[model samples]
Target: MRLNLRTIWKMIRELSGDDAYERYLKNFHKLHAHDEQHECDTPLSKAEFFKQWQDEKWQGIKRCC
Candidate 1:
Protein backbone atom coordinates (compact mmCIF):
# COMPACT_ATOMS: atom_id res chain seq x y z
CA MET A 1 0.00 0.00 0.00
CA ARG A 2 1.20 3.51 -0.77
CA LEU A 3 0.82 6.67 1.37
CA ASN A 4 -0.23 9.11 -1.30
CA LEU A 5 -2.69 11.99 -1.17
CA ARG A 6 -5.39 10.10 -3.07
CA THR A 7 -5.06 7.10 -0.82
CA ILE A 8 -5.24 9.27 2.29
CA TRP A 9 -8.26 11.10 0.93
CA LYS A 10 -10.04 7.83 0.15
CA MET A 11 -9.35 6.59 3.67
CA ILE A 12 -10.77 9.77 5.14
CA ARG A 13 -13.88 9.46 2.97
CA GLU A 14 -14.38 5.85 4.03
CA LEU A 15 -14.07 6.74 7.70
CA SER A 16 -16.40 9.74 7.34
CA GLY A 17 -19.11 8.02 5.20
CA ASP A 18 -18.39 10.44 2.36
CA ASP A 19 -18.00 7.73 -0.28
CA ALA A 20 -21.03 5.78 0.84
CA TYR A 21 -23.02 6.60 -2.30
CA GLU A 22 -20.24 5.42 -4.54
CA ARG A 23 -19.92 2.22 -2.60
CA TYR A 24 -23.66 1.71 -2.70
CA LEU A 25 -23.78 2.23 -6.45
CA LYS A 26 -20.97 -0.23 -6.97
CA ASN A 27 -22.68 -2.85 -4.93
CA PHE A 28 -26.02 -2.18 -6.54
CA HIS A 29 -24.60 -2.64 -9.99
CA LYS A 30 -22.73 -5.76 -9.01
CA LEU A 31 -25.86 -7.25 -7.54
CA HIS A 32 -28.46 -6.04 -10.01
CA ALA A 33 -26.74 -5.25 -13.24
CA HIS A 34 -28.65 -7.99 -15.05
CA ASP A 35 -31.68 -8.48 -12.90
CA GLU A 36 -34.99 -7.15 -14.14
CA GLN A 37 -37.48 -8.07 -11.50
CA HIS A 38 -37.98 -4.72 -9.87
CA GLU A 39 -40.00 -1.77 -11.11
CA CYS A 40 -37.24 0.79 -10.75
CA ASP A 41 -34.27 -0.38 -12.74
CA THR A 42 -31.93 2.42 -11.77
CA PRO A 43 -30.46 3.14 -8.38
CA LEU A 44 -31.46 6.10 -6.26
CA SER A 45 -30.07 9.54 -7.04
CA LYS A 46 -27.27 10.98 -4.90
CA ALA A 47 -29.61 13.28 -2.99
CA GLU A 48 -32.22 10.56 -2.55
CA PHE A 49 -29.73 7.97 -1.38
CA PHE A 50 -28.24 10.25 1.25
CA LYS A 51 -31.64 11.41 2.43
CA GLN A 52 -32.81 7.84 2.86
CA TRP A 53 -29.56 6.84 4.49
CA GLN A 54 -29.81 9.62 7.05
CA ASP A 55 -33.45 8.91 7.71
CA GLU A 56 -32.71 5.26 8.37
CA LYS A 57 -29.86 6.20 10.66
CA TRP A 58 -31.72 8.64 12.91
CA GLN A 59 -35.31 7.51 12.68
CA GLY A 60 -35.11 5.23 15.70
CA ILE A 61 -34.16 5.81 19.31
CA LYS A 62 -30.57 6.26 20.44
CA ARG A 63 -29.24 6.19 23.95
CA CYS A 64 -25.95 7.48 25.41
CA CYS A 65 -26.07 5.69 28.72
Candidate 2:
Protein backbone atom coordinates (compact mmCIF):
# COMPACT_ATOMS: atom_id res chain seq x y z
CA MET A 1 0.00 0.00 0.00
CA ARG A 2 1.47 3.29 -1.09
CA LEU A 3 1.23 6.21 1.34
CA ASN A 4 -0.05 8.47 -1.39
CA LEU A 5 -3.27 10.49 -1.07
CA ARG A 6 -4.98 8.70 -3.98
CA THR A 7 -4.29 5.33 -2.45
CA ILE A 8 -5.76 6.43 0.89
CA TRP A 9 -8.89 7.85 -0.74
CA LYS A 10 -9.47 4.72 -2.78
CA MET A 11 -9.15 2.55 0.29
CA ILE A 12 -11.64 4.66 2.21
CA ARG A 13 -14.14 4.65 -0.64
CA GLU A 14 -13.97 0.91 -1.00
CA LEU A 15 -14.24 0.06 2.69
CA SER A 16 -17.02 2.60 3.22
CA GLY A 17 -19.57 2.43 0.48
CA ASP A 18 -20.12 6.00 -0.68
CA ASP A 19 -23.90 5.98 -0.06
CA ALA A 20 -24.45 3.20 2.41
CA TYR A 21 -27.17 5.00 4.35
CA GLU A 22 -29.17 5.78 1.26
CA ARG A 23 -28.99 2.15 0.26
CA TYR A 24 -29.90 1.05 3.74
CA LEU A 25 -32.88 3.37 3.80
CA LYS A 26 -34.11 2.03 0.51
CA ASN A 27 -34.00 -1.48 1.83
CA PHE A 28 -35.47 -0.38 5.12
CA HIS A 29 -38.49 1.10 3.43
CA LYS A 30 -38.90 -1.92 1.21
CA LEU A 31 -38.67 -4.33 4.11
CA HIS A 32 -40.86 -2.21 6.32
CA ALA A 33 -43.77 -2.85 3.99
CA HIS A 34 -43.66 -6.49 5.00
CA ASP A 35 -45.85 -7.44 7.96
CA GLU A 36 -43.38 -9.97 9.33
CA GLN A 37 -40.60 -7.45 9.90
CA HIS A 38 -40.50 -5.28 12.98
CA GLU A 39 -41.87 -1.76 12.83
CA CYS A 40 -39.38 1.10 12.96
CA ASP A 41 -39.37 4.77 12.16
CA THR A 42 -35.61 5.10 11.64
CA PRO A 43 -32.22 3.65 11.08
CA LEU A 44 -29.07 4.28 13.09
CA SER A 45 -27.33 7.61 12.64
CA LYS A 46 -24.40 7.77 10.23
CA ALA A 47 -21.56 7.64 12.74
CA GLU A 48 -22.93 4.85 14.90
CA PHE A 49 -24.14 2.80 11.98
CA PHE A 50 -20.83 3.07 10.17
CA LYS A 51 -18.85 2.21 13.27
CA GLN A 52 -20.84 -0.93 13.93
CA TRP A 53 -21.00 -1.87 10.29
CA GLN A 54 -17.25 -1.70 9.83
CA ASP A 55 -16.45 -3.44 13.08
CA GLU A 56 -18.81 -6.30 12.32
CA LYS A 57 -17.12 -6.93 9.00
CA TRP A 58 -13.75 -7.64 10.64
CA GLN A 59 -14.69 -8.95 14.07
CA GLY A 60 -15.46 -12.59 13.28
CA ILE A 61 -13.05 -15.33 12.22
CA LYS A 62 -12.79 -15.00 8.47
CA ARG A 63 -12.67 -18.02 6.22
CA CYS A 64 -11.11 -16.42 3.17
CA CYS A 65 -7.83 -18.27 3.27
Candidate 3:
Protein backbone atom coordinates (compact mmCIF):
# COMPACT_ATOMS: atom_id res chain seq x y z
CA MET A 1 0.00 0.00 0.00
CA ARG A 2 1.13 3.55 -0.64
CA LEU A 3 0.98 5.97 2.27
CA ASN A 4 1.94 9.64 2.07
CA LEU A 5 3.19 11.98 4.82
CA ARG A 6 -0.28 13.32 5.46
CA THR A 7 -1.67 9.81 5.89
CA ILE A 8 1.20 8.89 8.20
CA TRP A 9 0.60 11.94 10.35
CA LYS A 10 -3.11 11.21 10.52
CA MET A 11 -2.36 7.64 11.62
CA ILE A 12 -0.06 8.88 14.36
CA ARG A 13 -2.67 11.26 15.70
CA GLU A 14 -5.36 8.60 15.58
CA LEU A 15 -3.21 6.13 17.48
CA SER A 16 -2.33 8.77 20.07
CA GLY A 17 -5.90 10.01 20.52
CA ASP A 18 -4.76 13.56 19.73
CA ASP A 19 -7.30 14.26 17.03
CA ALA A 20 -10.51 13.34 18.83
CA TYR A 21 -11.68 16.88 19.24
CA GLU A 22 -10.80 17.84 15.70
CA ARG A 23 -12.72 14.87 14.31
CA TYR A 24 -15.65 15.72 16.54
CA LEU A 25 -15.72 19.30 15.32
CA LYS A 26 -15.53 18.22 11.70
CA ASN A 27 -18.42 15.82 12.11
CA PHE A 28 -20.42 18.37 14.08
CA HIS A 29 -20.16 20.96 11.35
CA LYS A 30 -20.80 18.50 8.59
CA LEU A 31 -23.91 17.13 10.27
CA HIS A 32 -25.26 20.17 12.10
CA ALA A 33 -24.19 23.29 10.32
CA HIS A 34 -27.35 23.46 8.28
CA ASP A 35 -29.74 22.49 11.03
CA GLU A 36 -31.51 25.60 12.28
CA GLN A 37 -31.84 24.48 15.92
CA HIS A 38 -28.24 23.37 16.18
CA GLU A 39 -26.71 26.09 14.07
CA CYS A 40 -26.36 28.36 17.08
CA ASP A 41 -24.97 25.63 19.32
CA THR A 42 -21.23 25.24 19.50
CA PRO A 43 -19.01 22.20 19.65
CA LEU A 44 -17.34 21.53 23.00
CA SER A 45 -14.08 23.26 23.73
CA LYS A 46 -10.92 21.13 23.66
CA ALA A 47 -10.88 20.86 27.43
CA GLU A 48 -14.51 19.85 27.58
CA PHE A 49 -14.13 17.30 24.80
CA PHE A 50 -11.18 15.62 26.49
CA LYS A 51 -12.93 15.64 29.84
CA GLN A 52 -15.97 13.98 28.40
CA TRP A 53 -13.89 11.50 26.46
CA GLN A 54 -11.98 10.48 29.59
CA ASP A 55 -15.16 10.14 31.60
CA GLU A 56 -16.84 7.91 29.08
CA LYS A 57 -13.71 5.83 28.69
CA TRP A 58 -13.20 5.08 32.39
CA GLN A 59 -16.66 5.30 33.87
CA GLY A 60 -17.77 1.98 32.46
CA ILE A 61 -17.56 -1.53 33.84
CA LYS A 62 -14.05 -2.87 34.39
CA ARG A 63 -13.40 -6.55 33.98
CA CYS A 64 -10.43 -8.82 33.62
CA CYS A 65 -12.17 -11.71 31.97
Q: Which segments of model 2 are wrong by more than 4 Å?
A: 1-16, 36-38, 61-65
Clash pairs detected, candidate 2: none
Each candidate: RMSD: 2.9, 7.1, 2.9
Work out the TM-score per prediction. Answer: 0.68, 0.52, 0.70
Best model number under TM-score: 3
lDDT of each: 0.86, 0.74, 0.84
Clashes of each: 0, 0, 0
lDDT of 1 at 28: 91
Lowest lDDT block of 10, candidate 1: 33-42
Per-residue accuracy of model 3 over 1-65 as CA lDDT, tens digit each:
35688899999998778998999899988988678775366789999999998788787685677
The candidate with the higher TM-score, 2 or 3, is 3
Ranking by TM-score: 3, 1, 2
Candidate 1 per-residue lDDT, tens place, 1-65, comes to 46698899999999888999999999998888676785556889999999998788787675666
Rank list by lDDT: 1, 3, 2
Clashing pairs in 3: none
Clashing pairs in 1: none
